[model samples]
Target: MKNKKPKKVFMNGAIPPEKIANSIANHQSKTSIGAHSIFLGQIRADEIEGKTVQAIGYSAYEEMAEKVFHEIREAAFSKFDMTCAHIYHSLGTVKTGEICLFVFTSSAHRKIAIEACNWLVEEIKAKVPVFGKEILEDETHQWKVNK
Candidate 1:
């Protein structure tokens, strides 16, 4: 059954590793799930025009983004034979090497889980209205471009 409740998809700052481990541990009792796929998006310290990025400060139109996230989840459930899917993205400042996004999908088979996870990531990158400002080491900022 599709969950109709509005999911809160944004987290403040970076996603902690403990949260990831706890999520996996929570699913252990679901015996029917034969495979799981996970995606973690980490902040990178990229050098742009002689400046090195120190962190990314994220912001979004929350209402619209939540609605879009719901649509993406629904689309994934309908398009794939998946058992469950969860998405979490960071808000505010996330430093380099910190996790900013987490995508998790599980299914009875490996291929389905993998494909659904990949598709979710792509959809989010293309459709979500999340914006990031790259904070340089010197504290100057530039708008991030999704590539």
Candidate 2:
């Protein structure tokens, strides 16, 4: 059955490593899940035009983003034979080398888990209202474009 409760998808800042670890640990008891797929998005210190990116300040239309997230989850459940899925994204500043997004999907088999995780990432990139401002080392910023 699909989880009817709305998930809290946005975090205040960078996602902590411990949180990710705990998530994985929490699923150990679900013996029915044979495989799991995870995707982690980290901020990179990219040098653009002699400016080095130091961090990314994320923002979004929360209500709209939440609604879209729900739609994506529903679609995934309908399309794949997944056991469960979870998505968490940063809302504020996330420094270089820090995690900004975490996507986890599980299923009875490997293929379904992998496919669902990939599809969720793509759908989020294509549809979510989240925006990021790339902050350079000099404190200058530019709007980020997901590639």
- Per-residue lDDT of model 1, residues 1-147, tens digit only: 376787899999999999899999999999999999999999999999999999999999999999999999989999999998999999999999999999999999999999999999999999999999999999999999999
Error of 1 at 57 (Å): 0.2
Q: Give the TM-score of candidate 2.
A: 0.98
Against the unseen true structure, what C-alpha lDDT does each candidate score?
0.96, 0.96
Candidate 1 TM-score versus the reference = 0.98
Weakest 10 consecutive residues of candidate 1 by summed lDDT: 1-10
After superposition, which runs of candidate 1 have C-alpha atoms over 4 Å from their true positions? none
Q: lDDT per residue, candidate 2, 34-85, as tens digits? A: 9999999999999989999999999999999998998899889999999999
Q: After superposition, how far is residue 140 of candidate 1 from its true place, in Å?
A: 0.4
The Cα error of candidate 2 at residue 3, in Å, is: 6.2
Residue pair clashes in candidate 2: none
